[model samples]
Structures are given as structure tokens and as C-alpha cells.
Target: MAAATAETPTDRMPILAAVCLAAVVLPLGFAGGAVATPAIGADLGGSPTAMGWITNAFMLTFGSSLMAAGALADQFGRKRLFMTGIAAFAALSLALSLAPTILVVDILRAGQGFAAAAALAGGTSALAQEFEGYARTRAFSLLGATFGVGLAFGPLLAGFLIASLGWRAIFLSGTIIGAIALLLAGKRMRESRDPHAVGLDWPGALAFTAMLTLFTYGVIEAPEVGWSHPIVAASLLGAAATLAVFIAVETRSARPMLDLTLFRYPLFIGVQVLPVATCYCYVVLLVLLPLRFIGVGGLSEIDAGLLLVALSAPMLVVPLIASQLVRWFSAGALSGAGLLLAAVGLFWLAHVDPAASGMAVILPMLLIGAGTGVPWGLMDGLSISVVPKERAGMATGIFSTTRVAGEGVALAIVNAILASLAEARLSTFVPQGGAEIRAAAQRLAMGDVHGAAAILPALPAAEIHNSYAVAFQHLSIVLVGITVVSALIVFALLRGDRASSPRAKSPDDTGFDSIKTGSAMS
Candidate 1:
């Protein structure tokens, strides 16, 4: 409290700027790395599997290390971890830009993920420390908006850089941003740590990271090798066992980093579900729709990027608007209504032809982005609101882990579903129950029409595209159903109720109780 009170608005501005800069770099890596992958493969000459790792390596490590980073921030120091992370991120980005081989790129990408986790977990927690009450809400809202800016422009920027400056420019860009954030935070941000924090929860940390790694690996591999494949089966089983071990360790630990009891609070549970719901309703489409437009619809990369802009554009303003709307509406009602609107957009997107004029898709994309933006803006602030401020690092960590890990899982599941559905549709057209059709379907589902053609030289490209289109339509319907169900559940869980528990801490320093649906956010 002394640290917070000591900082005037002028002092806090640099802290906010630093965290926002770090936030922007993260999504840039996410979206930009995906865009740069093809170019990296072309220049470095790697197998499809190795090429996939360029992105997968970053995601797996980033998602797995978040919880550990969060706990460490609380124990060690948020400002200390934040500065270290940004410095490491800058160093790694420089190394990635100079990487001579695809293997080097993959390894560096993994390192980048670890750095990202530290920067995000520490930076966000530091933000919670610097700003309180309504100001905290506004700061987090700006953070969300900054993330949207990265996601919204990542593709277009990456595409331009790849075409004009080479793929290395993408990593170089990250380096520049990271260096700036590092300098700003190093000079101004004050260090803070939980006085009650104990020694690291080593067993729980190991188990949780292992669980995420195994599950993500299994999901990524499942689409390529059949689910029945021994490797995929082993990985998934191992993940489940590790998860059980993690739960046991946390429940028994004297100072568990995760605090599993938080799950007992309905408000806490509701806050967590928001990200997973958005992953399915909005995040997956960021990957899938581009594949549909370029591979199945025969659009150029430029055209595909434009459509993606349409899809993500609403994120720019919609989230800020949703923040203001909290003044009059229950966040629960707003969140539920937003998801329903996104579901409607998904339904419309399902029926629209991917190759059709851009206008046909623009309206639906806007609807989906605008709808999903509401929860995105609120979820960050709500994450801390439900817990004591001293535990802000842990709360931010849990929310972020759920968001990033949930995205990886969701993308893997949807990709698997699309591949399976395509396989079924391809069988009807090819009339052969063989490995060739299965292989071709997997490629088609991933938006690699040329690759599918290579495998099935006899099959017509039109038939392949047609099969993929039908599969995508089916997948969209499935997403629609899930979003609707998630909306109802979220509304029910979040509708104007305070979390109650004998062990729960008293109201935070701001004296605000758990955020309710219809109350002022402060």
C-alpha cells in the first residue's frame, strides 16, 4: 500500500506503458509467428513437422510455464521478474532473427515462450499493484485493447515484413519492442512481492507444466497420426495422470501456488470460464478462417489478410465500449449477450461462401469480434477483483494459463474435428477406405490444398476443396452450439452473486467486494 500511494499518476504512466508494450509484443509473436512460419520453412528448409514447431514450440512452452512464472513473481519480486523477462525476451528475439537453421529457430522460439510467460505474468501483476479500484479496471481495459491491436494487425504487418524485409524482420521487431519495455520498467516500476509467499511449490509446478506439455503435444500430433496411434495415446494418458498428481500435490501443500480452493468460489469459477468460451467462439477462427479463405476459396494471401482484418477489426473499439457499458449493465448479462451474438455470427459465417465477395463476410466477422470483445475487456479486471490483491500474480497467472492453454487445446480439437469430418466427406467422393484419403483430408483440413494434391495426385482439387468446405460448415455448426451453451452457463454463474467462503480474505484495500453483474465495476 505504501508503494502504491507513493506513485503519482506521472510515475504510473511509465509502468502502464511498459506493460502495454510487453502485451503488444506477445500477440505479435502469436499472430506474426504463424504468418512467418511459411517463409521460415522456405528459407531454412525443414520438414513439415519441424516447420510446425516454429509456432508450436513457442505456444507449448509459453502456456506450460505461466503458472510457475506467476508464483515466482509473487515470491521473488514482480518488478524483478518483469525486467528479467523483458531483457531475456529481447535477447532471444535477437538470436531468433539471426538463426541460421530451422532447428535453431524452433529452439529459440521455445526460449521466447518462457520469456513471454515471465514478462506477462510479472508485468500484469505489477499493474495490479500500481493501480487500484476503478483505475485498475481502466488500466486492464487498456491492456486488453493493446492485445487486440497486436492480434488485429499481426497478419498484415507480418505479411508486409516477410514480403519486403524478410521473415527475420518479424523477430527483429519483437526485439525492438522488448528492449523499449525493458528500459522503461527498469527505471520506474517499483518492486513488490507477497509477504506471505513461501518457498516454491516444486512438485505442483513440475506436474502442472508437464500436464500441459503432454496434452498439447498429444493434440498437435493427433491430427497427423490417428488418435489410436500409440504415441498420441501415451501422451494423452500421461497428461491425465500428471494432472491427477498436480491436483493431489496442490490440495496437500501448505502454500500451494495455485490455491485450488479458489475454484470453490463461484465468481472465481465464472471468471475462468470466460477465456475458454472466447477461445472456442473467437480465437479458433483466427487460425481456421484464414486457411478456409486461402486454400479452399482460392484467395491470395493479401485477400485473406484483408478478410482477417475485417474479422478482428472490432477488437479495436468494441472492448473499450464494453468497458464503459459496465456502468449500467451487469457484466454477466453483457458477457452472455455478447457470446450469443457471436454464436449468431458463427451461424452466418457457416452459410457464407468463403470465396464470395469480402462484403458477405465482413458483417459476420464484425459481429463475432464485437461480441467476444466484451468479455476480453472485463475478464482481466475481474480476475483480480475476485481475489485479494496480494494474490494478484497468482490470479493473473491462472487466468492467463486458462486463456493460452485453452486456446491451444481448442485449436487442436477443432483441427482434429475438421480433419475427421473431411476424411468422411472425402470417402464419399473417392469411394475408397484407405490411408490416402485420410492423409489428403488431413492436409485439406489444415488449408494445405497443394499438399493434399501432392498426396492424392488422382483426386481433383475441386473435389478436395468441396470436401473441406462441407467439413468446415459442420465445424461451424458445432462451434455455434458450444458458444450458446457456454453463454447460458456463464450467465447463470455470474448473475449478480458474491463469492462466499469462510477462508476467503476480507474485501481488498479498495473495499470492493466481488464484482457483480449490475454493479459499478469499482
Candidate 2:
């Protein structure tokens, strides 16, 4: 038994390595759009709306499939499911690279999203099952660290690759990474199958997927089409109905895709909600900051990327300190503090103008980063801590789903708000349809400084600067409100005592102990 317990982690190393490699692909694939959007549009003859779909499609599928894949991982063998996912993803990456049309690319992007969901759901669960106590905590910490690193490096790598090779090279790189991950997984990964696990809940999976697809589609399109549009209304109604059906089915099914009963625990529910709000604020700010720098401040892509480093750097370092801080502060406390800081940062950002230095703009990002950093590990730990080991996959699935869904919703909201404000401001500033006004409007939309500069030859420089500043101020107010609301939610939902003790055994200890008892289990 002792030998078997000791060997479990060794057997798991290969799969973990494969997971890490597969994980990088997600951030890379998602971030590639930021750098390659202009190039992709030029090549495909698509507009910014098409570009939005490119990323939105990926996120929607990724977020929607998580719970379904988690349940699948629980039903199937983790290693087998994980490898299968990577294989599918690799094939789709190649397809995306070779796609003849933007529509085809969108379809392939959706496929990639599904594959990623499988990999993430199966890999995270397998890691939890394989490791014990301190090792498990360390493994999870490393996972968070890797995720942050991937996000930080993805855009930079995409910029370099897109500059050197065509945007196709981004997909090509994914193919290589996916292939390597598959090979390593096939060779080194060990199967983790649960003989007594329930059968696949196909009905539940389908319903959940449909619901998310409708909701995501509705949200994404709402910005272009009015929310009251018949299609948008129908989509929203369909989403609600599908979700209702999903719940009803889960309640009646022998084995549900998501065990709704788990949410009864306050801690479990709180942890999930906390991340949703935090993630919404985080992604919105991330999206807005880069646009602000490039559009109004007139920084280059490379320069904006570097300035953004100040925001991401804290994420890398804060988690390490967070591990220790969790010993002193409750997860709720830390999370609430983080949200407050983020809100304050956004409020400060609202005051920045076209004349503000890069350093000044970056200050708010730094504050937001530091505030957001403290809750990273604590939230994950809290979510899974309350779930039984058998349900770890499900818990992780829900956790991931909520986080990504929040991100999508947040981006949509921010985009709608900013678009409306910018349009209104633009109309006020440039009433006529002249070349100079058209040029200024376009520059403001792209966040390009050169276009703004060109307009100065015809229009007053101060007026151009004031218009941009006014638009940004409105954006800041919304962001600040989001942050503050998130903070309040955290305070209300999270318990003060939940993170007080480090010695508390998670709910899954019994299942984990049982697994430790059997030699074949590891």
C-alpha cells in the first residue's frame, strides 16, 4: 500500500506533462486573435465582427463544454479521454490553418474549443485523483502558475509569429504543440478509470451545450443587433428554456452531468460565484487597457504588450505569496480585498486622458493585477475542497464554466457600452461626413493614434484629445462599478471562517483514502 501510494504520482507525471502542454494551446489559440485580427481580416475580407466571432466562438464552446467533458472524464478513463481530446484538437488546429473561408475557420475554432474543454476537464480531475494532501495542493498551484504564464506569453509569441510568418503559422504552431502532447501522453500516461462510475448522461450534456450556445450567441450578437431583435430575444428565451430543461433532467436522471445537490453547500456556491465576478472584471479591464494604450495613447502593439507586463507580472508572484497569505486571511477576505482594489484601480483609470503617460495608465493595471492576484489559488482550493473526490471533475467543470462564461458576458457588456458611448461621442464631435471626420472615427474605433494625429491637421488637436478622453472616462466609470459590485458580492457570499484553518480535511478525503488502499487504483 505504501509503495503503491508513493508510485501514484510517478505514474501521473506523464499525463500531467501532457496536460501542461495542452493547456498552453488554449491561451495561445485565444490570444492569437489579438495580434492576428488585422491580418486575418485583410486576408479573409472579413470585418471586425468576423474577428469577434473568431474568439467568441472559441470561448463559447470552451465554456459550454466544460461541465459535459468533466462528467465524461468521470465516466471514462481520464488518460484515454484526455488523449482523445488532444488528438481532436490537433486535427482541428490543422483544419483551421488550412481552412478556405472565415466561416470554415469559425467552425474549426468551435471544434478546438470542445477539444480544449475535454483536455482541461480530464487533466485537472486526473491530477487531483493522482496526488494526495500537500502534493495535490502543490500540483494545483503549479497548474495556476502555468495558466498565468501561458496567458502572459501567448500574445507576445503571437505577435512575433504573426510578424515573422503569416497568421497561419499560429495554427501551425498549435499543431506541433498538440502533436507533441499527444505522443507524450500516449507513451507516458496511465489510465485512471472508475469501475463504479455512472454511465454517460448524454441527454444532460446535449441540453447544457444547447443552452450555452444560445446564451453565448445571444450575448455576442446583442452588441450588433439590438437586444430586442427577434433573433436575440428568441436565443435568450431558448437559453433559459434549455437551462430549465437541463435542471429538470439532472434531477430525474440516475447520474446527472452536474449534480445540482453539490451547490447546496454555501462555500461551494460562494467560491464559484466569486470567480465569476472576478473573471468578468478581469477580462473587461484587460481588453480595455490594451485598446486604451494603442488607441488614445498611440503606443505600438509591442509597446502595449510590454506595458501590459506590469499587470501580468504580479499574477506570477502573488500566487506564491498567496499560498502563505491564505494561512493568515480567509479566502473570502482576500477575494473581497482584491475586488475592492480592482474597482479603485478602474475608477482611477477613468480619469486618465490622451495626454496621460504610459506609466500613469499602467499604474491602475498594476493595482488591478495585484488585487486580482490574491484570490487565484484560494478560489480553486475552496471549490474542490467541498466536493467529494468522485465529483472533483464535475466541480472543476462548473468552476471553469462559470469563470469563462463571466468573461464572455463581461466582454459583451463592455463592448456594448463602449461602442455606444464611442458612437455617441463621435457623432457629437464629427457631425459631417467628410474625409477627415471619417478618418478620425476609424482611428478612434481601432484605437490608433496615427489616425487621430492625422485628423489634427484639419481639426483642433485639443478637440481630438478631449473627445478620446471623454469616451475613455465613460468606460472607466463602468469598469469601476463592476469592480465595486464584485467586491460586495464576495463579501456577502464568502464566509469569514472558511479559510481560517489549513488543517481541515476536504470532503473527498474518504474517497481519496479508499483509492490509496488499493494497489491497482494508483
Candidate 3:
């Protein structure tokens, strides 16, 4: 790793703003794309299979590549890497806006996601290094709040912009904001790196990436192509083999990219996998709800965006609230409670027909939003808080990877579930169409009603609508089941664990050691 170097005086304001903006943009990229999916897909003539890829490809590459990028930030310099990531993210996003076809956009989105990994890893490391004591906790809370705001506001803003300016405007907006963040971050943040860092583990990185990619691909394609398809079987089998190799390599490596030893800590294991439950529900809904609103309710884009506030607004407010509540309740309490609330929301939502009124969607979303707010903020803070300052890079790596991977997998699983159900219900409606009706069901799951209808002349609109309504409830029940079971599991594992407990504090707390009294942070 490079030695720390002298730099210009650090300005916390600009650094904070830049990191917040970067975090905001990351989710904005996802949610905005979700808001704009129909327009983008329609223009690109994208099939349902390809439509999912527009978002999934980015998430797959981003989630898998994060650890490698985080390690590189530790080896090189975080301040520099952070700025470079911002710049690359801007360029790639701009390239995405100009892409003529959906395929090109998907390919570039993955590249942008890869670049975003650096921003995420570097930004969190910089924060942990610069802030300390109670102040560091405050910073983490604010950081989480800003992240929620970005996610919450994404649909609202993207809705307006896409309505007036078109879908490409969303990426163009990212390009502009990223440029501004690049300059601010470059001028304000100080340089730092891990002094004990060794060479990169290229083999481990490849194995890790391949494992996640193949597994995600298999799950996403299963409903469309069938689980027994040779390609799907190969992908899942390959993922398993690669996972074993990754674990073996990490256990043996002197300087592993991902320290599997961290799993020994039960709390770490619980907190790390928390995303699998929360995001598995949250992100899939983020995709499906918009589709339901626009496709079934026939709401305008702006109306749909406004409706989403019921979900994301509570998420935005909860972190700031959680930061203060830690004085009364433990992070684990808030997290577990949040999951239970989410389960309740899911159960409520499961009963709502797809053709239900807007209020039907809004009420459960508020409950889910409030529940979501509690955990994400604390879970994120704990991820870094649990580890020593030196291992912040690794912590963020695993943390970000888990969250994004869960999101991608959840989206895929939901898509598969809905598609499978759609096909089953639709088969009765279009019995004569055979395989054509089956393919149409996949399109239905991807939120492509027109595309699905275009494939079969006899595809009854009533049948299509009923199929989706049923599919949504089935997926919601699946989510409810998972969230409740997960909440119970976490309660069992993390019960009595308190954030205020000294046990929760890292023995190698960087807040006391990493930051010096005043001047600048280098």
C-alpha cells in the first residue's frame, strides 16, 4: 500500500457533500432507471428478458466487483480513487445516455456500476478515517439519511424529468452532478491508504465475480428458460464450484481480498446477511410497484412517483431518527423491529389486488417504508463500526456486496416468481397459443404488457390483468414469509446486542486512533 501523503487542508463540507451526492446518485441510477424503464424499453424494442438485464447487468457487475475495488482503494489512495471513480462514473453514464440500443446501455451500465463500487468503498473509508468518537457515529447517521433521501427522491425527480426531458435526461443529469462532485471531492478530501496492504489477488477476484454472476444469471433466467435448461443448470453448478474455490483461496491467502474469517463473528454474520431480507423485499418492490402503478392503474409517471413517497419518505426520515434513538434502543432492536414492521406491511400488501385503489398501495408502502428506515441506517453504520479502522475497506466491501447482491437476486427471484405465476394463469386464457402464451407470461412479469399482448393475438386483456394481480400477491406472500422468518432469525442471533454496549464497539476503533486533533486528515 502507498504511504500517506501530505495534501491541501481538508474541508469537511465539500467532502461530505460529495460523498452524499455520490451515494444519492448510486440509488438514483437504479430507481431512476426503474421509473424510466418503460420508456427506455419501448424505444429500444427490448424483450422482457432484455428489460430485466438493463438493471440486473449493472447490479451484477457492481455487486461482484466491489470487493476488488475496495481492496485497490486500500492498496492505492482512497482520495484519488474516489475522484477517479466519480469521473469514470460520469463518463460511463453519459455514454449510456447516448447508446442507440438497449444492449449497449446494459453493457455500459455494468461498467458504471463497477466504477460506482470505488466511490462507495472510498467514500465510507474516508468518512471513518476523518471522523471520530460520537462525531463519527453522527456522520454515519447523516450519511445514511442522505442515501435514503436520494433513493426516496429519485422517483419523484426522475418522474418529472422523464416526463419533460425524456429517459436519457436521467443519465445526463448524473453526468453533470458527477462532474461537480469530482471537483469538490478532489479539492477537499485528503489521501490515505492501508500501509499493510499487499498485492492484489487476481484469481480470487475472478472467482468471486464469476460465482455471483453465474448464480444471478441462473436465477434470473430460470423462469423464462426453465430451471432444467442445460445452461441454467451449468450456471448454478458453476457458481457452487467457484464459491468453494473462493472460500478455499481466501482461507489460504496471506492477503485475501475478502477475509472469510470475519464470518466467525455471529453478529457480523447476522448484520451482513440482513440485506438479503430487507433488500430482497425493498428493491423488488421498487421495480414492481412502479410497473403496477403505471401498467395497471394507468397512473401518470409523476403520479406514480408521488405515490412512491409513501415508501421512500419514511426510509429517508428513519435514519436521522434512528441516530438519536440509539440513546434509548439498540441498533439490533430497531433493526429487528423494522423487519417485523416490514413483514406486516408485506402481509398487508399481499392482500391488495393489483386492481386495487391507489390508497391500497400507499398505506402498506408507508408501513414498509417506516420499517425499512430503521434497519438500513443502523445496519450500514454497524458494518463499518464493527471492524477496525484498518479493515474499513474490507468491511465496506462485504457490506456493499451483500446489499447489492441481495437486491439483484431479490429482483431476479421476484421476476421469476411473477413470470412463473403469470404463465400458469395465462395458459388457461390462451390455451391454443402454447409456447407463445408461455413466452408472453415472461414479458408480463417484466412489466411489459404491450410486448406480451403483441406476441399473441388471443391474449385477453382481462386474463393478462388478472394474471399480474395474482402474481403480485404470490410474490408479496413470498416476501412476507421471508421477511418474517428472517426477522425471527435475526432476533435469535442478535438479541440483547446493543449499540451502546461496549461489546459493540470495535477494540481497534479508528475514531480514537485514526484522526488527529485538528488540522487536516492525511
Candidate 4:
């Protein structure tokens, strides 16, 4: 068995570096969308709704391609697929920078998402192929840390680039990073391939993609078009039908894109669910925080961005302490506790009125940040630990797809809730006979604060300000309820026992040895 052979320090160096680079670049592509929203909207002459399609386009493609890309990684060589993905992503970024219209930019963004999915799926699978047992666990932790680093820094980088050179420069910077990483990867990385990998599951891929596309599109548009609209209703119904077909196909296929049998492992299933719920809660908070600080609190854009530094500070601090916590507590306990803390933090945030200072909100943000960090690190490690090495690519893909789906749902739900609340609230204020107030409230609800000043003629300044403050407070309560529900779901899925540790087997254990031998043979 390959497990019996000792790995020299040099043998691990190249793949480790490849993993690090892949981790940083892939997430940067996704995170860049969040900060570039305002600039993109302004330059492209699109409203907030159109700008949202920027993310929706990328996320839909990215999430949908995961399983297919993972299968490709297993069939072809990981290094080859990864380099191809990086090159494609870099080219797309360059194209996006040069795009003359919003539609072109969005198309490029979708292409970039496809490239990113390939890179992430291939590169992370390569990491699993190169390491095992405690080494694999540590490698996954470092991968999580790298992802956190990207999440923490991507916005700050985007903000700086936008401030200095405009939004075009942001895509240019991504192109440069992707080019550099591609060059480094080509120079140092070795190939990893499985001979036994079955032919491409085209029907499975198409069915799954159709299902995800319909579902994400329905969720994304439901807030604006109303759930009962023909398009929304069709999308929702199509998604259900497509998903059912996908499951039936997978069950019958000789080589399924997703081996549904994996779900039979309760521990593995529980571990995967942790990230889904955590990601949903985390994205919801991230989306809402900027609005709270800048839109309602009346801070400058720069100040609001700076305030986020408090929320991100823990990403740096928490990784150093995470391994220690894992040693002392089970992943389930740690994850559940983290979700609980985040819920509490969200509840605390709900009580924050417009008058609250940055200091008052900073603590809760920090707590939520720290709490979320634990599960973020544990999730990938736990999911992969229980799966066979040959299935690592598929497992990681599934876990990632689930996490992104959770994010999409979170964004959709929050947007729906906020839109509903804002409309309901606006109706009450509109009846009070202030046209200016009604328009300003409508703009705020639609996430169009830049156009807000144009609509503030029918009311005094004080009342307009008060209306926004009240709306944000109501939105915070919705976020609080979301976190609480998220916590409950996580707790229910996670088993309480420490004995369920995914990485419990030692390097010499048969379970570990078998996977390594099977992977090498394949």
C-alpha cells in the first residue's frame, strides 16, 4: 500500500504550493463580485437588479459545474485540468475588463465561474491525492485557512483597486494573479489521474445543471417577479422535475457523477451539512452588514468597508487556535457551538438601533466571525476524511456544491424577506402622505441608495433618515431569526459524540490504507 511508503519533505512541497495558490485565486474570483457591485452598476448603466445577475450568473455556473468538473479531474490528470482552468479564468478576466457592455461582462463572468469550478475541483483533489491521515487533515485545514484569507482580503483588495484605477482594474488584477498562478502551477505540479474513472456522465451532468439552474434562477428572481409569476412558477416546477430525473439517472448509471450511496454514511452526511448551514448564515450576515453600517448608519462607504475589518480580524486569529480546539473537542461539538455563538451574535445584532456606535456592534461581529471560522475549517476536513481516496474529488465537489447552494438560498431568502418587509413597511409610510418619504423608502428597499437623494423631496430630512433606520432594524431581526433557525438545523444534523471523529483512524489503519491502495491502483 502507498500508505506504507514514507514521503520525503521534497515530495510534498510542490503539491502543497499548488494547493495554496489554487485556494487563493479561486475564491478571489468569487469574492471580487461582492465589492465590485457598485462600480459595475455605475459603469454599465444597470440597476441593482441587473448587477445581481453578475453574481447569479457566476454562482449558477460555478455551482452547477462542480460535479462534472470533479469527474473530469478524476478521469483526466488533475494538474492538466487545473492549469487549463486557470488559463481559461485568466483569459475571461481579461475579456471582462475589456467588455463594452453589461451583457458582455456578465457572459465573461459566467465563463470565469466555469473556469473557477474546474480549478477548485481539480486542485483540491490533487491535494487529497498527495496527502493522507493526519497529513491530509492538516492540508485541508491549511486549504480552509487559505480560503478564509482570500475571503478576508479580496474585498479590501477590490476596494483599493476600485478606488485607485476603477473596476476594470479589479478584473485586470485577477487576470495577473491567475496568470502568475498558472505559470507556477505548470512549473511545479505533477499529474494525478485515475485509470478506472468511468466515461463522462453527460446525462447526469445535464440533468443536475438543469436542476440547479432552474432552482437558482427561480430563487434569484422570485423576490422581484413575485413567486406566483409564470416564469418563477415554471422555474420552480422545472427544477423539481429535473432534480427528480437527476436522482433517477444517478441511481441507474454505471458510473454516477454523484454516488448517492455515500449518504448512507451518517457521520459523513452530518459533517457535510455543517458547512451548508454555516455558509448560509455567514453569507446572510455579510450581505446585511454593509447595508446596516453604510445605508442605515449613514457611514461613508470607506468607513463601512473599514468597519468590516473588525468582522474579518478573527479569520486571521482563529485559524491558529482551531487545531487546538479540534484536539480538545469533537467537530460536531465545535461546529454546533460555533453555530450557537453565531446565532447569539445575530440576535444581539437585531437589538442594534441606528444610534449604536461601531464599538457596540463590533463585539458581536467578532464573535460571529470567530464562531464561523471553526466550522469553516472543520467542514472540508470532516467530509473528505470519511470518503475513499478515489472519491475525494466527487466528495469535495458535492460538499462545495452544497455550500454554494446554501449561499444562494441564503441570499435569496434574505432578499425576499427584506423586500417583503420593506414593501410592507413602505405601504404604511406611504399612506402617511409623504411622497419623498415613499420614494426614498422604495429606493432603499431596492438596494439603490445612490438614487435615494433624488427621491427625498416630500419629507423633511429627519423623517427620511428615521424611516431608513427603522427599516434596517427590522431587517436585522430577520437576520437574527435566520441564524437561530440555522443553528437549530446544524445542531440537529450533528451527532454529539466525540467518537464520530472523521479522522479517527491512524495512518496504519486498514480504512486509511485501503483508500490509498485503491486510489493508486485506479
Q: Which candidate number would show the highest TM-score if scored against the true structure?
A: 1
lDDT of 4 by residue, 1-522 (tens): 112212664767666776677677666666656666666767887754566667667777888888888888888877778888888888898898898888887788889878988888888887777775667767777888887777677666766777778878778877888877786677666677766787679999999989988887786676566668899999999999999999999999999998887676556677667766675456655555655555556564445556766666676657546644665455566677777787677666666665465778888778778878877777776667665687767877888777765666666656665655554565564675344443444456545554554664544545545555566667766656655665665566555332443445554543322222322122
Q: Estimate each model's TM-score.
A: 0.94, 0.85, 0.93, 0.88
Model 4 ranges off by over 4 Å: 1-7, 291-301, 354-357, 431-446, 450-475, 485-489, 496-507, 510-522
lDDT of 1 by residue, 1-522 (tens): 214532588989999999999999998888777767656766998755576677778877887788888888999999989998988998999999899999999999999989999999999999998886778888988999999888888777877787778989989999999999988898889989988777678999899889988887887777677789999999999999999999999999998868898888766777788899999999888777766676667665556666788777778898888888877777778889999999999999888875665678888888899899888887887777766778888889889988887877787778778888988898897787577887787777667778788887788877877777788889999999999998998898776454343134445533223334324353
Global CA lDDT computed for model 4:
0.69
What's the true lDDT of residue 76 in model 4? Answer: 86
lDDT of 4 at 393: 74
Clash count for candidate 4 is 0
- Tens digit of per-residue lDDT, candidate 3, span 1-522: 433322322557677788888988888898888888888877887767777888898788888888887888788877877888888899998998899999998899889888888888888787767766666666777888887887798888888988898888989988988988888888778888888778678889999999988998998888777889999999999999999999899899998998877676667777775778788657778888887777777777778888887889887788778666766665566778889998899889888877565788889998998887887777776777556677778878888888887788778777888888888888777667667876888877866676677787665777777778787788888888888888877776554343422234344443311221111122
Cα lDDT over the full model 3: 0.78
Rank all candidate structures by their lDDT, best first, as comma-separated numbers: 1, 3, 4, 2
Better of 1 and 3 by TM-score: 1
Tell me the lDDT of model 4 at 505. 58
For each candidate, what is the lDDT?
0.81, 0.69, 0.78, 0.69
Order of quality (TM-score): 1, 3, 4, 2
True-vs-predicted CA distance for residue 230, candidate 4, Å = 1.3
Going through the candidates in the order shown, the clash numbers are 1, 1, 0, 0
Error in Å for residue 386 of model 3 = 2.0
lDDT of 2 by residue, 90-159 (tens): 8898888888888888888888889988988887777767776656665666676566666666666666
Question: Once model 3 is optimally superposed onto the true structure by TM-score, how far is the C-alpha of residue 138 displaced, in angstroms?
Answer: 1.3
